[model samples]
Each structure stands twice: as structure tokens, then as C-alpha cells.
Target: MALPSADQTGNMAEMEMQWAVKAMHHAETYMQLLKAVGGKNFKLTPIDDELYSDFKRNFPDLNIAVLNDDDFKTDMAKAKWREFINKYENRVTDFNFGSLLRIDCTGDYSEDNTMFVMRTQFYCIEIARNKEGLNDSHHS
Candidate 1:
């Protein structure tokens, strides 16, 4: 198949950017809603112990345990992660706007703990967390 032309690629990038912006807006809304119900002190835990262990069991290299390890906390580690994650590029479709991944469920929010990643990955990690009631809104 022929590669997309420059115009096509540019249009796609523009669409992706718009989608990402909208996604970020929705995330803000979610944050507000969760805070209203769960309290201003609320923070979404990425996953519970069982899920975390399962995630590590399935993809040991991407486990949360290694997140702060010296070998995985450097620029080279980030690059390595990108390279490792790219291996799944063909499996994902219906791209979502980039979403944030927070390292700690507690403490003040900052760029230090948050990682922006593709919508699919955010959904993959968060869907389970949500399903498990990590992000349940208690206001109702």
C-alpha cells in the first residue's frame, strides 16, 4: 500500500491533537467530579495489589516495582520503555487522546509523577482500576 501523503499525515496529526486536547478537558472534569464526591483529598490509585501483581506477572518488564529502580528511572529507561511499548503498536486501534498516568495516588499533583501516554494505554490501565472501584464517584 502507498504511504499517506504529507497533507493526509498533517490532517491526521491535527485531528489527533484536537482529540488529545478534548481528552485532557474530560480528564479535568473527571478529576473535579471525583474530588466533589471523594473529597479534595481523593486521588485515584492506579491499581490495587492484585491487579498490580497481575500486571507484573503478565508484563514483568513493565511492572510498577521497577518504576523507581535505578535502572528504570533514567532517560535511557524512558527510551527503553518507549521502545518496548512500541512493540504493541499493531495491536491498538481507535486511538484516544493522550492521557495522564500518575505514579502515586497520594500527595500533591505534579509533572514529576504523571506520565502522558497514548489513550489506549491509559484506558488499558485505568479500565481495570475503574472497574475495581478505584475511581468510583461517591457523591451520589
Candidate 2:
């Protein structure tokens, strides 16, 4: 996407780009964590391996095709890009923190084809840094 104009005050466009980058980075980290945990048990079909290899081989081309498109300057294009990025962020956050589950039923019934299931639980902690300056600047 085109970068936000230098003088724009409410820079939601740039913010969306920043958020997308952060979300993608978070996804990569999560994938790395999954790989580290699954190690030997991690199963990759030949098709999956080939697809991933191709993605790696042409990542720059794919990224340029997606992100450097000429229509990004238009308001409709920006809005669409924003919507896509928001959806992506919501999906990632759901996978990480939301109560969503998926079951894989890939094989024959006789073979007991319930292959995979996953549950994710996430927690957050916040600490107050200082209340000393709270509301004082407003009064002044």
C-alpha cells in the first residue's frame, strides 16, 4: 500500500500498515513456536512442503504484487485495505486468544479420522505505572 501522506493528521492508513506488519510478525512467531513444540511430531505432506517452498522462493514477488499495487491511493482502495487488515488482525487474535475451535475430519469413518483439534488460552496482565500526574495537567 502507498504510505500515508506526510501531512495527514489522522494517519489510519499508516497505522493499518503498521498493524498488518505487526500481525504478520506475530503469526510467524506463533508458527515458530508451534514448530518448536511439535518438533518430531510435526507432519508436513509433500504438497504442503512444496507450497511452502514456493512461497519462500517467491516471497518478494508475491509481496510486491499485493502491497505495491497502484490503486492504494484511492479512498475506496484504502478502505478495502483497512478492512482486509482488520479482518486479518481479528483472525490472528482469535486464533491466539479467542474461544474458537476447529476439528479435522479428513479420512474414512472406519479409520477413526478425527485427526486434529486445538484449544488456545491466553492471558494478560497490566500494571499501573504512576497515578501522581493523573488529571493534574488537565487542571493546569
Candidate 3:
């Protein structure tokens, strides 16, 4: 379905909410990949330090604060959110991680309608032995 027009400023807040839900789905896919590979027992190598440094330099305009909590409440938060979204969008386009599984949204102009989209990335990594069988244990 077509996305709502960008001119609908009155619905910006709702649009932002929809964006957040979509971002969370992206995060969820990461979490699920961790689980499928062996849950907490798996060890992901730290993202390459040099690559991360380059990431910072190459995407100076991208905001990394979305990964932090305090930035979410500040007045500049919207810029940060946009940066975060742009970063992953670029990641999908660059094929740096894995694949963009989906980006789905709903609603046209109705208050009751909502929109959602998701992008997925996959990576191949060595899975450490499930020493604790943590996957089987329940934690609160």
C-alpha cells in the first residue's frame, strides 16, 4: 500500500510512533538471530573496531544515540531518531549486515489505522557451545 502523504503534519506524532514500532521489529530480528544461533550462550564478536571507527567517520551525520536512553528524552531526540533510522536504512542498502526482510506499513488517513515496517539483517558467526543450556531456562 502507498504511504500517507508527507504533508500530513498533524499526524506526525502518530507517524513517529509507527516508525518506532518498525525499529523495534528490526531489533527483535537481531534478538531472534541471537537465540537461533544458541541464545545467551552464543558469543558475537565485537563489531570490527576499525570498521566501527570508519562507520563513525563515514556517517558523521548519523546519530548513534538511539542506542542510548538519555538521548531519547532530549529536545534534539527527533534528529537522533531520524539519524538512527537512516543508519539502518543505509545498512540495508549497503548489504553490510545481511538482508532487508521486510518494511511493511498500513493506514492511509484514518485515526484507527496504524503503520509498521521492519528491516532485517543477517550475519554468519561462530556459535559458542551452549554451556548453560540457557535457552531452556526461564528467567524473569
- Using lDDT, give the best candidate's number: 1
**Candidate 2 TM-score to native:** 0.24
Question: Please, what are the lDDT tens digits per residue for candidate 2 over residues 6-46?
Answer: 58657668876776566445444533533354322332222
lDDT by residue for model 1 (1-140), tens: 99989877775767888876776675666556655765334333333344334444544555331134443356886566456446445544433336665454332235686666655445445444444455454334
lDDT of each: 0.50, 0.30, 0.36
**TM-score sort, best first:** 1, 3, 2
CA deviation > 4 Å runs, candidate 2 = 1-11, 39-140
Candidate 1: Cα lDDT at 60: 55
**lDDT for each residue of candidate 3 in 12-89, tens digit (9 for 90 to 100):** 788677766655565455446544654454333343333344445644543332223233335685465345446555
Positional deviation of 19 in candidate 3, in angstroms? 0.7
Error of 3 at 85 (Å): 11
Screening candidate 2 with a backbone cut-off below 3 angstroms (N, C-alpha, C), the clashing residue pairs are none
| lDDT leaderboard ranking | 1, 3, 2
TM-score of model number 3: 0.29
